[model samples]
Target: MISKTTIDNVFDTARVEEVIGDFVQLKKSGSNFKGLSPFTDERTPSFMVSPVKQIWKDFSSGKGGNVVAFLMEHEHFTYPEAIKYLAKKYGIEIEETQQTDEQKKQANERESLYLVSEFAKEYFKHVLFKTEEGKAIGLSYFKERGFTEQTIKKFDLGFSPDSWDAFTNHAIKKRYKLDYLEKTGLTIVKDDTSTGTATKMFDRFKGRVMFPIRSMSGRTLGFGGRILTNDKKAAKYLNSPESDIYHKSKVLYGIYHAKQSIAKEDNCYLVEGYTDVIQFHQTGIENVVSSSGTALTPEQIRLVNRLTQNITVLFDGDAAGLRASLRGVDLILEQGMNVKICTFPEGEDPDSFSRKNSLEELKSYLEEKSQDFISFKASLLASEAKDDPIKKADTIRDMVVSISKIPDVIKQEVYIKECARIMDISEAVLFNTLAQLLQKEQRDASRKKRSEKKTMEVVASEKKPVEKVDAQYELERKIIELLLLYGPKEEDFEELILETDEKGEIDFKPETQTKTVFRKIYLDLQEDEIEFTNDAFKELYTAITDRFMREEDLKVDDFVKVLEPEKAHAVTDILMEEEKYSLHNWERKEIYVKEKKHSVSQIVSETILNLRRELINQKIKELSETIKQQGPDDEQVNLQDVVDYITLKKLLSEKLRRVV
Candidate 1:
């Protein structure tokens, strides 16, 4: 475990904006910073970071938390990993206490998998550098491809020997389990049918140069191995099988290294192979990632979308390759991102083209040749159409399908005009085509919604239970907000005790006293034995009251660290929400707004009274239901129950007017 003092130092030194700004492009928005949401695709900036509070909120995706929480969510890091990452980034030394044997033995499955993957990565790299076979075969192959030793080591490129048991034995000797080894697809096992008792076990990527595929956070999720020798019966390139950590469709090669550069440039360069990405980086173009030879997925697109709105795809002159990637272009468009295509020279792919040209020449070629996807697709299809009117019309429809995927209407309109000119069609014709496509999609969606709704209505009638949403949900939220915002402040509170006078009027006595907001709320709730009805509210109430009992200063950063992700997000939502309205700067227009702090006492009191009234109403509802389902002698209703319900309702109404 990391010592508390070290964690505090990390938190104090690592600025939230600086950490998040590495992955996102944030523009200053008044007192805070705003950026496109890393959690979702959005045109306008909705992800806000507050340096004052050390928290961030993505209104688009409803995710919010402090710096450590952001790292955990964005990188899929364990708590300790997140802390370590921050400590390393800000150069804070971490102090870890020694764990007992039992504590050490408690490593969970995911952590074990992570450890095994990491071990495999380092072991493969060691073999490529140290052993005789690795240097002669693996290092020779990389050098032959014009990759310098620095490039090879930077990407952690490695060689797996042909001897099948070499890696398997080495791993097992290190106490790594065969279960995780096989689970990660690093080792293969085959049944020994002749013996009928034991199985054959060996390495999965023997005689192949290894490319470890990593997640955005630099965790090795899997590997892509290219065979060194050409064997007709064997596959040329093989990848790790699907596991909990490695999903190829979602994992883009070089993303871990390229994310910062992509954000820095505000544009991402997309390629198709591991070498292509490494080659681009070697050639001084750092903002490049590969889809690892798979068709683009929404998840993969979203990974780049977090860093930039613009994507430039590098394609060879091969018509087949371009055709194969057309669907990927459509996926990018569907994500509401700007995509361009830059074709390399006639006989060269990104790998070879990059290796052949100087950095300036390659960058100049890209600038001269890049085209918006609309222009690229239309021109490519138009050339293929070749003055054939029917093919030209079909080509326009295909272009319309691509254009319809764009989410921004203005961009769609611009693309439509460009397509019309390229296809020699009227602008009105393309507009109609786009409208038809959108209508058909919406109609299909409506049909699905209706069918799902019909089934849901039946299921809901028969199986769904009452929601039991506390009528005081908003009140409870307000109370929590008050507790979080003003709980440390000492303020005067007036306690009212109401009694009926001899003249049948209400008499009130007020006792004025001062207490901390936390103390006042704790005592008030305790006096009435009132608990928040919502589970989250109830949990938050307990956490706050318990924390305040032993501490005077309520540090939100410290408090949020102890909470679960969901509860931490909730607390940040309350803390960060009100500051956003102020960002618009309405006060500059000479419109004054009242400060909420001045009314804190009244807001807190009214919320508590409303909550108590709601609880009473819930009881009254129970009593009325009891009467409705009662003795056969009075099936219609019971007189005593009716009188009790009416009396409770009247008392609740009186309490609603003024709290006692």
Candidate 2:
């Protein structure tokens, strides 16, 4: 367990924007920062972070909380892991209590997988440097490839021994579980039933140089290994199988190291392999990542999209490889990002070219050689078409198809005009082609929707009915919001009291009481025995009230830091819900929005009265239902109860100045 003092230090030192900015690209928007939501695939910016409140809200996915919650949600870190990550980032020493055996076993499976992967990364690095076989094979290989000792260690490069059970035995001997090793694809366990021998365990990356594939946060998720020897029966390069931590399609090589550079440069260099990324970094180009030779995926592109809107894909000079990679450029355009293509000299790839050039030479060549997707595609296709009318027409149509993938209308129009100039085609013809492609896409989408609707109609009768709004739930949520926002502020509240007029009749009068807002709310709810129906709200209410009982002053930002993840998320959602309105700077447009603090007393009194009225209406409803199933004697009693409840509700409505 992390000590409380250390946790406080972490929260105090870590800035919400700085910590989250490490992962998402944020631009200043009024008082807060806005960026594309990392949780959802949206082109528009819906994620906002408030520095004053020290919280963030992703309006797209509805996930909101403080710094630790962002790490927990985005990186899927355990609570302790998130704390430790922050402590490491801010350079705070953590104090810990020793864990019992049971406590250690209680860690979740995902965390266990992460621990095992980290262990493998360390073990491989130790072998690469400390063992003779590793030094001779792996160290020599990297050094010969022009990778300095600094670069090799920077990437945590390593080697697996040729022996079948070297890594597997080492991990198990150190108390790591075989189950996790196999699941992470670091070790392969096979049954040997035919030979009547014990099950065979082997290292998956045996005799291969190891490259650790990490997440954006720098956690080792898996490995990619290259074979050292020519073995006709084995794959030349192998990657870890899909696991709980690694999905290759979503993971980019060198992303952990390149994110900051990508954001700083406002451009990302996309390549085809791990060596290409490392070599570019070695040549002083830090803003580069690799697809690991897999086709580019939208998820992968979105990862870079969070850092920059510009991508320069570095391709080899081979015609076949260039054609294959051109399709990925359309995917980037579809994401509303700018794409540029740069190819190397004949017979040279990014790895060899980068290794051979000095930092200055490499940088200059990239700047001068890069071309926008429009010019590159047009010229390449024009050469291939070569005076054939049919092929020329096809080439023109192909450029239009790529232009249509862009989401911006102005960019599409600009690209269309440029394509016409380059391909010697009429602008009108290209516009018509773009229109036809877009219409066909929309029609196909509509047709798919219609087919899905027909399929859904068959089971429409079995679908659950939509639920009506829960008035009590909303009222309870408002109560929590008030407590969180103005809990410790002193205010004069109008408490409704029962009194008698000159005649012997009952009347309601307002009695003024000065107290803290939290105290007022606490007394009212306790007086009525009201409890929140929503579990999250209920927990938050209890937490806030308990804090008020123990302390005179409460800072919402500091208070939310100590809450459990779900309750903290609930608090942020309630607190920042109104902050969104202020994000648009409506007040600057002469459309001033009213501040809630100005009428806190009225809002608090109305909320309590409304809650009371809602509870009475619920009781009246229950009595009415009881009246339906009762005998004559019971029916008269239930009817009288309903009548009394209605009278109370009417009085409450009158107090609120609302018509029933």
Candidate 3:
């Protein structure tokens, strides 16, 4: 467990803007910094970071939190990992007690895989440059592919030695496990069929040039190896098999390297191969990633969704394989991404195109050739559909379906108009087609959910009952909000109790000026222990306690901008909710003083009622526990006493009933 002092230190030292600015390119916007949303695909900047508040909010995605939460979301760092990252960045020393071996061994599985893969990556790079065979073959291949020494190292380009156990031997010598090697598909195990005895395990990518595949955080997840020799039996390219850590659907090649650039440029240049990503990146187009020669998944598109909305897909102009490759464009649209297609001349892919041209020329050519999906599709299908009604109808349907995949209604409408202009079809016809498709898609999705619910019902019936949430929490939250927002107001009205100092006189003083009553009770409450039911409240309570400790003033407006937007808005809603009747200055007529509203009165009454109810409920719980401890034999209930307890309970319940 992290010490409270250390956690406070982490917050104190790590500026929210400084930490967030590392990942997001924030430009000054009033008292805050604004950037393109890191959690959504947006051309316009909607992500706001307030350094003064020490918080951030993504208006597009509605994710708002503190700096630590930002790192946890954007970098996918665990809380501890994010803390460590910030600590390193801010030069904070973390002093802590050591964990047990079992705790240490329970490292995050994703992190463990990354560590192993990183080791393998380094090992492969070592072999490529340090060893004799590696230097001759791997080095020569990369050099021939127009990769510089810097680029080779940048991509972790390497060679696997031809010897079967070369990598296995090195990994074992380094104390890595064979099970992990097999699990990650880095090594293959062989067994004798006759004797059922293990023969030997060897490297999976033997005699191949290695391209390390990485997750968004620049951690190596797996490897994609290319075979140099064109053997009839061996596959040309072999990828690490799907493992517990690497999901092909979610991982995009070069995302780790390109993420910042993509975010900075507000565009991602998506290609089709590992080499293409490397080549473009090497040529100074850092905002480039590949689909890794696999069909694009919605998950892959969503990975890009985090950084930017504009995706320019690069492909060859040749039509032979273009149709199949274009399938992903619709998926990109489904994610509300801005889809643009750019195709190179005959016999050229992005890899070849980039290599042949200077960085400036390549960049300019891409900008020039890039066309909207509607324009590109119209051009691609026009020749085939020339003068054929049935084929043209089919082509029009395909285009409409692709356009329908666009998530934004406004974008879809815009596309409909563009398609009508380009294809000479009525906008109404296309819009009608789109409506049908969307309805059908929604129906299919609903049916799938229904089927899933049936499966869940059977599974849930066999499981233990889930705990019911406490019903008083809402009331507790409301009371806490009132205390945090209005407690310190000097002239604000507050409930109080007054008693005459005579022998047997006690008086219930219903209401008084807030300052006197609150100052006394608030101080008293501070002397006693108080715990909030949730983290947000706990943080707020801590903030309040700090103020009280320092004899500092507290105000709703002072804390409003100090909290993250969601929390601030929550606080704001509570503080300002129906507190007073509206007054117009124009109609004031040198206005006489109007009596103050009963907002605080209602809040106080309800709070006191809820408090009494909570106290009674707590007493009941204690009595129940005591009865259980005493056992049924020892606790012989008195019917009359039970009736009296029930009567008081009903009175307390009646008070609570007035609150909700």
> Which numbered prediction scores highest in TM-score against the true structure?
2
Least accurate stretch of 10 residues (summed lDDT) in model 1? 635-644
Model 3, span 173-271: residue lDDT tens:
976767788889998988889889766788999999999998776667899999999897998889999998788887899987897888788999888
lDDT of 1 by residue, 356-382 (tens): 999999899888899989889988898
Off by over 4 Å in 3: 1-66, 69-80, 87-110, 194-199, 442-469, 475-493, 498-507, 511-609, 617-660
Which prediction has more favorable lDDT, 1 or 3?
A: 1
Taking all chains together, each candidate's TM-score versus the true structure is 0.87, 0.94, 0.76
Candidate 2 ranges beyond 4 A from true positions: 98-102, 195-198, 457-460, 490-495, 510-515, 533-535, 582-593, 623-641, 658-660
Please report how far candidate 3 places residue 79 from its true position, in Å: 5.1
lDDT of residue 252 for candidate 1: 90
* Local distance difference test, candidate 1: 0.85
Top candidate on lDDT is 2
lDDT of 2 by residue, 559-621 (tens): 889888888898889988987775566778999888899989889989999999999988998
